[model samples]
Target: MESKSYLPKDHVDILPCMAAFAVVVETGSFVEASVRIGVTASAVSKQITKLENILSLRLIERTTRSLKVNAEGEQIYEYCKLVLESSANIFRVKDKLVDNPQGLVRMGVPKSLYATCSKLIPGFLSAYRDVNVQLVCGERFDFVTDSIDVGIIVTEKPPEGMVARRLFDVDFVLCSSASYISKVGLIAHPSELAAHSCIPFVGDLDKQYWKFRSSHENCDVPIPGRYLSDCPEAALTATISGVGVSCLPVCLAIDALRSNQLIKILPDWIYKGALQGTAWMVYQPGHHVSKRIKVLVQYVMADLSRLSTTWKLM
Candidate 1:
């Protein structure tokens, strides 16, 4: 004695069929609808048949040569048209974003690479006026918890499940201010460092050795720290201020070396210390990358490429 509901219980399951029905109605041929929908004509016929079975109504009258929409089919076609339009609008929004990107793109950067990363951001924002960048500078980064869109890290091997672009190799070299070198005299060999006031980046006591490698041999000097700091930038600043000879990344020390503020010691030897590897710009891999992040990555890489030429980072 109760009135029955007309709509199917699993209404959400029929969206694809509704879309096919709408396309078929518009095209007036199953083969033509299949072309538009990127499916076979038989597949389109099956979807229509399934839709009719689900609703328990014959929505279309068909013969070998002719096809016609019944009264119920005509009513359903109106609602189906709306559904198709709504689906199209989803992709249209993405297209608009791609053409003219506008949004916030958060970047995670380590302190070691902060100077280089920060310098490029202003130019990126100037070019993309609608997009803004937020630099989350730290020693380490968490992609999910930090909501980081992009990150720059120094590592021998980049983490798995990421898209990594190697910017440049980080080369560490022992350098000191010209004044400090003049006072301490020239270091001809690795053993000479032990005699001079050394600034080792000792966050803890365990990292006390500076390993030097030439093409022919390797030398490990145990550093007795007259001045020490964990941060590379601090060590760099101290060395430039004539505090003591400290190991510094070449990219960090290049400008100083060119300006003759810092003098490179033991030029034949490579610093085989803890901080050594290539710096990579990394992001999560996905089929659909946002326009803002995509443009930013391209812009930053281009800038770094130009810098690498001048800095000889390659």
Candidate 2:
């Protein structure tokens, strides 16, 4: 038996190992990839190392501060995405054969829509009991690279190479705590807003320019704020706490307005613009369209249409 030994001691399956490597590259960290795939960090590292050994190439550069995919790894990542997508399609194929929306649907949801999404989840699940959902939320998203089935985004234009269906045009209503408005006195016109303490929306710029529109006139006001933030919830909190007057989304401020926590200023003037911003359901049209994705999009469109009737959005 000792004399006849010529075979290798260890054998490895390439599929899962390759998948681990892909996830690592996609997430850009061994720890994050492990969390995504439900494995240990050591396991993710070993799999990528094993894949590198098999190929006889260093796909990624390992540093103490960062892990970067080299040129070769970038080329390999494209193929890896194809491989993983093909593997994912196997489930889609099965679902098609069975004529049922089953298995998992990975969706990217923006944090701003937490309230809307919470309302939609129960109804969607009840309609398709066999379909399972996994929602991924973050400050930023790249749907193509992250393997998201669909995404909800707020933008005037969709990301290049992705398809979009317009959900609604965002309308901003000027809101402030009743106390703030009472202290500052009434804002009879859009021009009067310039004199009051204004809480402007924070973007990449130092100053935020707010535009107001109507059938007869338009006004643009450039303003500054001490307590500036890019988050909607933060802006709403500051407004409700009587910090200053801010323009907030109608959907988000509906309950507050109804409860009299926040008072709407300039009742007839519209600050929301289609040219300024809009909400969309975006996805890669070239990718496989699973039954689950189709139904979810339909559900969202139908639900939002119903909700819009109450809030004056389309």
Candidate 3:
């Protein structure tokens, strides 16, 4: 780790010295080199002195008012020029990558959102052939720990220190198959659910409840059922098959509802429970986002905007 270990005690480092030496040679004057490097002329002169002392060679011949690189300095300057060109090329390649939408983007998506996000990714990849996507499916994710480039999160407000764009509100509707409703006989109030076969989502145990909100009041009805599942799509499937009544996101059931395959159980009441929030696309805040991530966010946001309109009609 110590550069001094490779040289004598009094000898200074080589890279900085070489850089200063090369600059002085190319500019032809210590003052001009110092200006280009944003340093004082004396500092540049000191670097050249340290470099000469380390090499045990006089690389420059200078007088009170004139300066010139000798034959030895000229030879070393050629290698220095190559080093400088290599450094410049490295930065140019980095700039090209940052400005181009071409790389793998890792995205974290909640499990239930598969029905929504799965539809958008293929089109994005088709439109930007050079870009690739890796979808990480889960209920929750830590962007830093998980190395997620962008993700969908459901919350009342966006998490702190993240750049977020609201996609839509996370809402659900109480629905079941028309055959199940006819078999059980239609009931008017939310309390009637207690007597019927009500479906509980995956984690519920002992007791399950459903919240209902109307213009005048809110109700919490106890849900009693024999079927349980974690996936929203599965819940919609079970409800469509007349297994029981379940609360499902409108995005997942809008098409079925439109086709009369499923009917809303409480049309006048909106389900207002744990699943309510504004779904947002969040990523780490930075001065410059990578082009791959930027394009993915833009594409997903636009697609979600169009999809949200259909949810309203349902």
Candidate 4:
């Protein structure tokens, strides 16, 4: 008997390459597609080639000018969309099984939180043994398509279309190493801060203009700093080294305050606002909340609640 030409083994399943194809079709460039998917452009091209070879048809008419999808490619794109949607549903159904929440849960967290909250993650993992958590930490927003399940952001306004659960309100305090403050003299008022060497957290300086309320009057003071860093940790390190005074979240400065490594300056003129910064748990609405996502969210909320009570600035 002659072997079948289109055997199951001979015809590779398209499921694996579906994601790549969808990204390429959407981005219209292999390089951009790779960036969105967090892979190299060559890898994307290879995946597309594999997909075309499996279907025995040219899907994309590649040229320097544009990446146009042929008729076959258009049909495949539609089918892939349906496949992905169906796959999402399958995952949703499977998620109902609490016995195991086995799958990747990509989470985005702030760098400062990682410094303080990284310790809590081990306990979360221990409790949810089946859930695989992938934590991505950064100072800036990393909100690419399908990249994260939950994002923890400290912002005044939440992004549109995403559910925002106010985890906690954060306050910033003007702090410095005891030696630094001693050398520069403590700032007694928001205006006095101009004389001190302030360290600014990059991208937040404009928003960080120190605000204080006194005797029913509000003060918004714009202070200059000689040092600036994108990472809060860097700012903290600089303060610790006696480089300058810095405004940092009370949560991040508590240990230093207790240890006398850093001293709170301008105690009377405390910066106060309605949680100048809020930590939010954001996720796309309408997407099925898998058991892993649910468990992770619950765990994080519980953890945040505990931290807020213990470390929240009054």
| Root-mean-square deviation (CA) per prediction | 5.9, 17.5, 3.9, 16.2
**lDDT, residue 168, model 1:** 84
lDDT of 3 by residue, 1-314 (tens): 66555575544347778888888888999999999889999999998998888778899999999998899989888876775677789999888787667989999887557778999999999998889999987757889899999999878878899999888886777888999988998868888888888776663222388888889989888888778777777788888999988887778888899999999887888777665678899998998888899999999999989888878643
Please list the residue runs of candidate 4 whose C-alpha ends up more than 4 Å from where it truly belongs after superposition: 1-97, 138-146, 156-160, 203-208, 272-275, 312-314
lDDT of 2 by residue, 1-314 (tens): 55334434433266677788788888999999999999899888898898888878899999987899999988878877776898889978886746978778777866556567668978899999989888876535777678788888878778887789988765667889999978888888877776777876453232366777778999877665657776667888899999998877687788889889998888888885332367788877865677788888889888987786676532
- List clashing residue pairs in candidate 4: none
User: What is candidate 4's TM-score against the reference?
Assistant: 0.62
Ranking by TM-score: 3, 1, 4, 2
Candidates in order, TM-scores: namely: 0.73, 0.59, 0.83, 0.62
Model 1, 16-111: lDDT tens digits are: 999999999999999999999999999999999999999899999999987899999999899988889999898898888999998999998766
Q: Candidate 4, 184: how far from true, in Å?
A: 2.4
Candidate 1 at residue 187, lDDT?
90
Model 3 spans > 4 angstroms off: 1-14, 25-42, 54-58, 63-79, 203-207
Best by lDDT: 1
Question: Candidate 4 residues 178-211, lDDT tens each?
Answer: 8987777756778877777888777464645767
Q: What's the lDDT for candidate 3?
A: 0.83
Please report, as a residue range, the 10-residue window in candidate 4 with the lowest summed lDDT. Answer: 7-16
Could you give me the TM-score of model 1 versus the true structure? 0.73
Clashing residue pairs for model 1: none
Q: Give the per-residue Cα lDDT of candidate 1 at 289.
A: 89
